[model samples]
Target chain A: MAEQVLLLDFWPDPSGVRIRVALREKGVEYEYREEDFQNKSPLLLKMNPVHEQTPVLIHKGKPVSESLIIVQYIDEVWPHKSPLLPTDPYEQANARFWADYIDKKVHYFGRSVWETTGEAQESAKKELIHCFRTLKGELGDKTYFGGDRFGLVDVWLIPFYGWFYTLETFAANFSIAEECPKLVTWAQRCMERESVSKSLPDQHKLYDYILEHETGQNQPHL
Target chain B: MAEQVLLLDFWPDPSGVRIRVALREKGVEYEYREEDFQNKSPLLLKMNPVHEQTPVLIHKGKPVSESLIIVQYIDEVWPHKSPLLPTDPYEQANARFWADYIDKKVHYFGRSVWETTGEAQESAKKELIHCFRTLKGELGDKTYFGGDRFGLVDVWLIPFYGWFYTLETFAANFSIAEECPKLVTWAQRCMERESVSKSLPDQHKLYDYILEHETGQNQPHL
Candidate 1:
């Protein structure tokens, strides 16, 4: 039986880009369907009825929602090539812990950086910088988050680098490069891979997209 | 070397209870340390510097934080006994999706039900009911969330049942049993298991503990 894989995603979405990178890393051939939040396609709605959000991976007609879960799924299904998670149970757990930290702290604070202004934005900026520095400490002298291998934690985090332009442009005096240089270098290293370079939209393009959409608090909803 | 296992937790914590249940299900004997949030132990801080929250499982001196991640680690390490997750990649993904949903929706809104009053509490009550109903639909006629085996989804959810008394008592016109009968029945079925029955604190005791802590909008922080 032939393998059928489909991924529903929205352009310039960090979560969606994570799945794209994972798929490209695994060399998995999949049909990409872009979803419109306003008029969501029936396929996406049917596939992910609960969340009805982007980055749902449909493998053999079964849907898997959530970006991290999809990435893990992709890794498990295509285990022969470029293993994402470590084989040791303890190491896998540790990788998952960092990935969870990225999801809970890094992503959450990053949203606040571009979404708000004044004291709220300042606090978020501080928090985001702290998060990056913490990640830098975790990375230490390692080439990748998984240490020499571009693995689970790397896949979970590298996509956020695509939003660096928007975050720096919107949030006052914010420079991730200044705050965490090692993380910047790590991201650059990740970008050298074709899978990452192709999967992430140009950071400038993402900035323009967010600006065009007027996503900040003061701006009117389009 | 003898396997060294230790768990640090707070009594009546839903998250902590989850790890305890998983440990029991795996039949892994380990030392349990109760933590006092007022003056947190140095070990808790050292073990889980990132979150600094309860339910840090230390196995062979390596700490695994986050209840869900710890549960997965236990499952992987003790695969010889009761399986916590399915072997199939798709099934595992599906289980993870629901577990994530419980963490995001069910637990988040359940907090609101006890922590707010008036309009906000009423809104939370309605949302909690809707969440339970959605879960009911997902559960359907399954004997457990994993179907015939109490697996990931069940482990993620049953801990919340310990908070049912507090949620119902605090939120006006809210009754999970009335709103989602099958789900209530499912909780009862889960309670039959020694691992679940022992791990979860008595619902009434949990309610009293929350009351003593005075954790609500109007209550003074003690």
Candidate 2:
């Protein structure tokens, strides 16, 4: 039987990109079903009834929700090439920990920078810079977050690099490169991969979407 | 060289209990250090600089933070016995999804039940019941969350059972056992295990601690 792998995804989602990058790395041929956030597909809702959110990976009709989990699933099921996680348990745990850190810390602060304005945006920028600095410290001159290899953290966070342009331009707080030069270096390093570069939407396009929503323009594209 | 595994934990923490249970399941003997939340030990801070949270497991001077991550690490490093996670990638993802659900949904609702008051408390109760119903529906007639053998979900959730008494008695909103009999039965089965029973602190004592804190009584223990 031919392997049927389907991804219910949204373009702007960093979470969705994690799975996309993983699938690409694994060279898995799968169908992509775009989800309309305004009117989420019934298939997506049914596939992920608990969250009713997208970036759901359906393998052989069995759905796996949560992007990081989906990425791990893909890596495990198709363990031939471009491994997302380290083989050693300790290293795997470290990678999982950082991916979660990105989810909990980076994802929220990154959103707050765009969603809020004035003092709140400034605070968000400070928090974001601090988080990036911490991430940079962890990266510490390494080629990627998992060191040398473009693995879990690279896949999880590289998508957010597209938002940096908008975040710096829109918020006018600080340049990501200035605040966390090493992290920006890491992001650029990740972009060298065809998988990382192709999986993410264009940065300017994402910026325009953010600008439209911020200015109360009708986001027909969004 | 002799092996060294140290756990920095606080009693009454469901997350901490997860590591303890996993450790016991593996039958690995190690030193346990209780962290004072008000004044966390220097060792705890140094070990888990990223999170500065406990249930940090130090194996031969290397630290693993985050409760669930630590739990998985324990399972991986000690793969010979009492495997906590399923070997299959799909099942592993399923277990991870539910654990994340418990963290995002159950963790919040479970805390809000006792932490808030009046209308907020009422809303929390409603949400908590809804979460349990979903969990119950997931559990159905399974002996354990992972079917016959206890697995990740059971380990992740059973710690919260100790809080059930405190939540029901103190909040006076609902009885967990009454709402989710199957879950309660599952919890009872888990408590029968020596690993689980030894890891969790007594329920009523935990309730009194909650009462004291809520009533503005001096919490020497806390």
Candidate 3:
């Protein structure tokens, strides 16, 4: 029997982009169904009843929600090509640790930088820079987050490169490149990959979308 | 060379309890160091510089932080005994999804019920109940969360059983057994295991500690 793979996704969501990169890395053929956050499709609502969110991977009609989980699933199911996680148990745990760290710390603080102003935004900017610097410290002289291999942590974080321009120009006025040069270089390196380049939108395009969405000039997209 | 394992933990912290349970399941013996929250030990800080929180497991002098990540590390390191995660790729993802769900949803709302008052507390209570019911629906008639096997989701969740009495008597005033009988039964079945029973604290003792801690009549523990 042929494999039936479908992905419910949104273009600008870093989470969805992560899944797209993973799918492309695994060379999995999947039907991409775009979700409308204004009125989420019944299929999405049904597939991910728990979250009612996009980036749900439907495999043989079985739904898998959560982007990181989906990517891990993709890696595990299609283990032959473009291995995303380390085979060594300790190394795998380390990769998972950093990926989980990116999930918990980076996104929350990054959003706060652009979404708020005054003391809250200032604190968020500080914390976000601290997070990036910590990530840079972790990266050190390594080619990627998981060392010589472009693996879990890289896949999880590179999509956020799309928001860097907006974060720099629109909100914080702080330069990530100035603060964490190595991480910026790492992002550039990741962008060179076909999977990553295709998955992430142009940073300027994302910036414009953020401006439009914030000013109520454009329809909301999740 | 003998394997040197050390655990920096604080009793009554559900996160730490989760780690203890996983360690017991793996049948690995380790020295347990209780961290004083008021004056965190240098080892704890040095081990987990990012979060600086406990349930940090040190194996061969290297540290693994984050409760769930530590648990996964334990499972991987001690794969020969009491496998915590599923071998099947899809099942592993499913278990991970639910475990992540518990991490995100359960603890936050559970805290809100005990910490807030008035309309906020009422909403938190409602949401916490909704979360429990969702978990119950997931459990259904299964003996354990991972179906027959007491695995990742079960290990991650059973620690919260220690908080049930405190949650029921001092906070929400709702009975989980009444709302989710099957789930409560599942908890009881899990409690029967030595690894779980030993790792989780007595519910009544936890209630007293919470009362004293909230009333500022006792030293704070994390």
Candidate 4:
């Protein structure tokens, strides 16, 4: 089979990182092309016309939008090494459930926390803490989200661990790890994997980038 | 194989309807058990401990939460009749993409429209219209979202059509067919199916229920 070029319209996005991690874990070789939202490449627009958002992966000239969907596509296309999802239908659905849960609840709650102020921020923070605690309880004895193996859910969420720490520092009102020790430990275990560790950016650097942008010192990384 | 007793913890939710539609479409017989959020059943709580929300499907003792996940699970488990998804990997991922897009974007924007007031309401309405227009463009010349057949994405989103006329009546701000004629047509085509027609309740009834609940009536249906 000819090698497919994977064009990723990404910008340090945790969602995009999931696909990158999956590709890296699977050892799938593909060409990468970065996209700037302010000046979006025509290819990106052509690929995902509806959302016109980032993290669009162009595989064999066909564009796959949505991070989780792209990750699943990559998994299917390259199923030889380091399978991202479970083989069993039930287990696969369970993995997808957790992944979707994180995407909807945790991801949205995190954004709500960052995008608001005062009462709204307080409310979002409360929701975030609740989400983290629930996830911690679920992660109780498992080394990874998908039991002993690092599977789809783990890859989808591990990138957010760095961002969570950034939020804890910048917000200065909450500590995700302190609130959910098991989640913190689980995150640490995920980061221990070379694929995850190598793919993730520095937490403090991300914090500085966010702070600079908010303070008008840095431009939007679109 | 033994007849699987599907224990569904559902309420009058559009998300739950996704699974209900899938079950009906596949001609799968399953038991339905409605859940009360105010006083959740132990089974519901145990099934989905993290979210503690409805639309939980307990099939052969294993519980599946998340509406889309349950829909896919049902499709995988029972593939003899009308298939909910495409067999081709790319096509399956594309179907999943649109189904998820509707769940995230359309559903979120619709909730914003419902929960806001004044300027916020107007903004949400505009957003909803934009989403509808985009969807309409995507569905241009296609009978269903799955291109010739009524597949996963169609089943996942068609139930919301029941709310469109009601939203137009109460909100008195937007017109579904007027704004997105193609989408309206596609929705109409979907509703024409016996499976879809039989599974959903009347639009006016749902509207009245919403109005009653909003005004503190809290009736049984509401």
Error of 1 at B162 (Å): 1.4
Q: Give per-residue lDDT, candidate 1, residue A189.
A: 98
* Alpha-carbon TM-score of each model against the true structure: 0.94, 0.94, 0.94, 0.86
Candidate 2 global CA lDDT score? 0.85
Clashing residue pairs in candidate 1 (N, C-alpha, C atoms within 3 angstroms): none
lDDT of 1 by residue, B1-222 (tens): 256899998878778888988888888888999988878899999999998888899998999999889999999999988899999999999899899999999988988887788999888888888889999998999999999998999999999988888887887676788889899999999999999999998889878878877564543221
Chain A TM-score for each of the predictions = 0.93, 0.92, 0.93, 0.89
- Pairs clashing in candidate 2? none
| Number of clashes found in candidate 1 | 0
Query: Candidate 4's residue-wise lDDT over B28-55, tens digit each?
Result: 7788888865678888888888777778
Q: What is the lDDT of residue A49 in candidate 2?
A: 94
lDDT tens per residue, model 2, A69-127 = 88888888998888789999889999989988998998889888888889999999999
Every model's Cα RMSD, please? 2.7, 2.8, 2.5, 3.6
Q: What lDDT does candidate 2 reach at residue A142?
A: 81
What lDDT is reached at residue A56 by model 4? Answer: 81
For lDDT, candidate 2 versus 4, the one ahead is 2
Local distance difference test scores for all models: 0.88, 0.85, 0.85, 0.78
Give the Cα error of residue A169 in candidate 3, in Å.
0.9
